[model samples]
Target: MFEYQLGIDFAKTLDKNDPLALYRNQFHIPKDDTGNDLIYLCGNSLGLQPKTTKQYVNQELEDWATLGVEGHTEARHPWLPYHEFLTESMAKVVGAKPIEVVVMNTLTANLHFMMVSFYQPTPQRYKILIEADAFPSDKYAVESQLRHHGYDDKEAVILWKARKGEELLRYEDLEQILENHGHEIALIMIGGVNYYTGQYFNLKQITNLGHKYGCKVGFDCAHGAGNVALNLHDSGADFAVWCTYKYLNSGPGSLAGAFVHERHAHSKTLNRFTGWWSHNKQTRFKMRDAFDQLPGAEGWQLSNPPILSMAAIRASLDMFNQVGIEKLIEKSKMLTGYFEFLINALKNEHIKIITPKNQEERGCQLSIQVKTADRSLHEKLTNAGIICDWREPDVIRCAPAPLYNTYQDVYNMVEKLKNILNE
Candidate 1:
């Protein structure tokens, strides 16, 4: 824990000494109508655009304009192997081997694709277990998967609910669920970080626990990748998926990344939906060859990727490769700790933070639960030129992304909130 002090000067001093402060200039922070930079703290939802993203996307456009169909093989990055360029850097971000990572379809799509292979449910072990308050998309995906396999969705889906009056989930409760119903549970798919409370679950602990119960474990890391050192390979998870737009600073709705454990990389019996791209790269263009599946995560691909989206992803991954997740996380803890300090300093009775106090148990995001306050509090903050997100019910999720957020931004945001509350 850091001994944080009060006031603007303390924040200024922290920003002045920050080694990563200069990196904020690389992003285009949104502005108010007066043209001043807004305190953008919504990286958990949509990251601010990297200034280099335009240049990266433009390169692909130029290649298409000049070379037409030859762009697939002759472009600067070469469209045929375009997704390959992202593998190493993306793997580093998520802590996996290049062979275990692939940048492909959207987040939910990748989750379904991974489920197709990993979520094989038998009559005896056909139920799915998930966090009770999982992101809606994940809950829907699992429910649909349950229904698809001829099980009653409501009956087959098990919820790992927080104890009454609790906002965060306890591992002991999850262990209890496994103890009671582990035999019936076919898969344990959870969000690496609870999207609402911002509590980061221990991937290795969960994986080991599920495996002990003979359940395949996977994570939807949409809120974890680029925000934490997931160490997916070492976690021993069966699979994981995440989007590039948030924290990675890629453009909105850009490509997502997927991971398959190295143990399953060469398995020929894994049931997956594949296309020409998943065939042996050597014979992929033969046009008459059979579908000889490629090994590792690439074997899950169903089509050629969109070059423009991959280009934007490359632009962000290049930045991540330079800064490294370790240094970024180092700054992230300090920055978010300072945000927590300032918010707590307000001593406001109307609001309290729901995110974990332990830095190791969370990322940059802090979810503030406002007592009896509605969306109007969020609208007030927005009108004051501070941009964060409002989750349903009563939580304001503000993520001080270390790469582009500074101590000064945190200081200014809290000061504005204090004023708004006082008014």
Candidate 2:
């Protein structure tokens, strides 16, 4: 329904008609040394800081300074239930029920925690399946899980990889793997969105395939949580984990999110590591009581959270609540589609768009493979005031975040890329 043209005026026209266009101004766009706004297209790596983030975090700091010990209950947000404030909005972001979702530790840490309860392995079925290109942290976590359970890491871990000449994975291959190794596999944990190729997997499909094989299913949605409609509950995955620092726009090292399907909310038989925070809130302060596991995902908490970090997440989630993820995703498709249009229009054989072309199978990120080019191309782009990131070998990941990016930004980035490539 959209005809993409090549010009700044067309991009400006599109921006003028965009309902979320004004949201761009709500962020602090990094400026070049010359005081011009840098073309930031790295939301997949680190999102631009929301202008209100400071206010949200400072509110807590002021409460601590003024109330001291009383801040736990006397503060406006009530530190006693600080994480609860984030539950509804975060659940909305990932399309989950509040009881199924919780804001907890960092991403990899949360991944390991979820594995403890979900990755139950036995001698007959003890292998774990993951994407061949999973983020290094996930790979390490899963491998360690296998070794921790007295299995050889290399022998117990299975990689669902792309075909010999392909970069994207196919479900047929996964089905084949399960058909053969189904009995031997204990868990299937893959990135909901592939970090390097920007491919969005079908979570429900993966979960179904794993369940059919009698293996537990999980996803690391660090890239998909805020960027797509995850529908974690409907997907019926056993659990999922993701961080807030990316599209969620929380600060660096901010608290991550976790999801446990409602079916497992009160599964007392499931093994889990817990702390006082996971105890029943009503009697938590009693000090000398037996452990009463709080039902749902909240029971996974190991400690009282970092309020300052959680405050930043609260700020970002509030914006997400106002705009809604579905609306943001609609804009994301248009923004990233426009980005793809311009890249293809270049027709430069030296550059290839490695990410999937189908909007339904990808997020805002476009992983561009600069054929035969090295890090020098990335350096030149950085010098030209573009804030995209360079992955090792030959890919540059650029994401036009719907919350704070414009059509004009996409147009300008492509124009700059064209000029650089022509030179």
Candidate 3:
């Protein structure tokens, strides 16, 4: 907390003292149709673009225009190895080693690639376990993997589900599922943070549990990559994948990240879909002879990437490196805590938080379950210049991202929620 001489103006004082407050200026915050700054609390869905992203992208455009075909080898960011430049910072953000991290295709594509290596279904252990409420894309990816392996999803996929009337996951239940059905499961692919409920699951525990059952373990870190401490390497996941377009602040539908455990780095027997990009960099230009997969995460890439998108990711990851993920997570805890405090002070039954109550169990977003559970509540918030996300059935998610959001934004959103509930 900012220890400073202050009066009752917690917001004004909080904003002035916030270490990351200056970051807000770096982003192009959205403005409503009426020309007012939208509260913009949806970073979990899509982060605001940094002003530097344009410059980074333009560098590529200029390189393409002037250098033409030479850009792959001669440009400022040399397209041939553009992904390597992002590896160090991207690795830092997710607690991975450089060799373990690679910028590659879209989220689901990366997920499938990881699955290809880690989710090797055998006759004795052929099932894949996942949280019941995982994002649809992940579900589809795994189901397809099951079908690809010549197995039926109904028999080969085990969904670790939340109990009836429960809003969050129970580690005990997950363990129980592993204890009972672990023999059938070939792999356990879980979301490090639940996209719907904003629950940050205990990754280390999940990994240990799956290993205890002799099953390979992986994580889908889509919601957790930038929002929480993933520690993918330490968590010992067989593989992990995440998108850059969300909290990472890259543009929409941008490139994704993948990580493979170091222990698996040298395994020549692991199956992978190889391409020119996956070949050893030193010999890739040779374009001949036997197929040689690069060690670690880079080995999974299938093709040359879109450098324009990689540039945006590079710009953002550099910002993350400067601010430091530990500091950002610290700020995230405080900012999200302040949001929780204000919302709880409302003491209104109409608005209920569905996210886990403990800080360790969550990140920045709070999933609000309105009593009325109507779509109009989201409409009301939208009209009031509050940018939040509404899920199917009944949940409005608001994320006060640590890099740009402030206590004042939290106050404004809570105030708007109060007015909407009153109506």
Candidate 4:
């Protein structure tokens, strides 16, 4: 019935021809009870750890064990300036310059830190604008930021909601919100991509609109960092932050990244909560009485970071660098497109995709709105060893990570899903 839809064997042929197929060997794919590979489709949540993560983290562990306090100066990866080792490669991943980016803290902490400098809510412009369906952590962060500035979140925060009966956000509605509240909105902090709908927002368009309205702009890129080309440097956002544990494949609950536009890098007077790492590296160990800050995003650092986490990042960044973001994205487009094709071929009318249909509007993830099916259907998929996630109210997000997922995996997933739905 799907002569053009291609079979599981055809997907295998494509995988054989894939230039990035070799990357699958670099990661440790999860296996099921019988020792079969569990088709992992949750890279949107936590990525598979790179095999080199152990080697990189071991370097730090050995240093801490042997050099102790001296590890800062004597270790293979010096603890004092350890984060510096990752600057170039990490910057490339998000299309940033070395000075524009820094890896530190967790996702929420970095958001709080970025807000300290960028959110600048004033008397006339005290409101914060965010997506109505933002991640719970982000909602809390913005709400608390409003409260911290002596404003009620109920009154001071504006939500850009998805249209009624629609799961996706529209750019036109965003334009309308900006036209209405642009003057009072202090900052436009949005997720570069919506997690639930798998929609990648138009960053440049949003940035332009917010800028035209005299509002500072920022993005929470947790879902966009590795899944899509955030083009953060070119997007003209005032600042952006993301966690590495997601599609970046760093590790679970890993260190996060923060970006500051170059224009604000040297703004020493920009308000921030600082610590020793944020201090000038030259003057940091001087035992000075004054609190001197560093330049660029490094100025946001609060404490000496966990080096082991940095090592895990370095390991993953190396993989990203070797594979190149552009190539990975290219493969992701094809691989995900193939998955979409196969699913659309399903004779069952019960499954519908909630993610945007256009390639430009999404990444690898597809939020399947299982028509008339309950959570038990997802339980069956899980039992069948399809490692996908089911969110509340009936949405299952499946991401075929370019770094490891193959076309055959997509074909197999759809075949099983078809069979189960039929039963």
lDDT of 2 by residue, 1-423 (tens): 788888888899999999998898889999999899999999998988999999999999999999997999999999989999999999999999999999999999999999999999987999999999999999999999998999999999999999998899999999999999999999999999999999999999999989998999999999998999999999999999999999999988888999999999989999998899999999999999999999999999989899999999998999999999999999999999999999999999988998999999999999999888889999999999899999988999999999999998989998888899889
TM-score of every prediction relative to native: 0.99, 0.99, 0.97, 0.98
In candidate 3, the residue pairs with backbone N, CA or C atoms under 3 Å apart (3 or more residues apart, or in different chains) clash, namely none
For candidate 3, write residues 32-72 as lDDT tens digits: 77787889999998999999999999999999999999999
Residue-level lDDT for 276 in candidate 1: 93
If the candidates were sorted by their lDDT against the true structure, best first, what order would they fall in? 1, 2, 4, 3
Where does the lowest 10-residue lDDT sum fall in candidate 3? 1-10
TM-score of 4: 0.98
Q: Write the per-residue lDDT of candidate 4 for residues 230-288, one digit (tens) a residue.
A: 88889999999999999998998999999998888889788899999998888888876
Count clashes in each candidate, considering only residues at least 3 apart in sequence or on different chains: 0, 0, 0, 0
For candidate 2, the lDDT comes to 0.94
The 0-to-1 C-alpha lDDT of every candidate, in the order given, reads 0.95, 0.94, 0.89, 0.91
lDDT of 1 at 141: 98
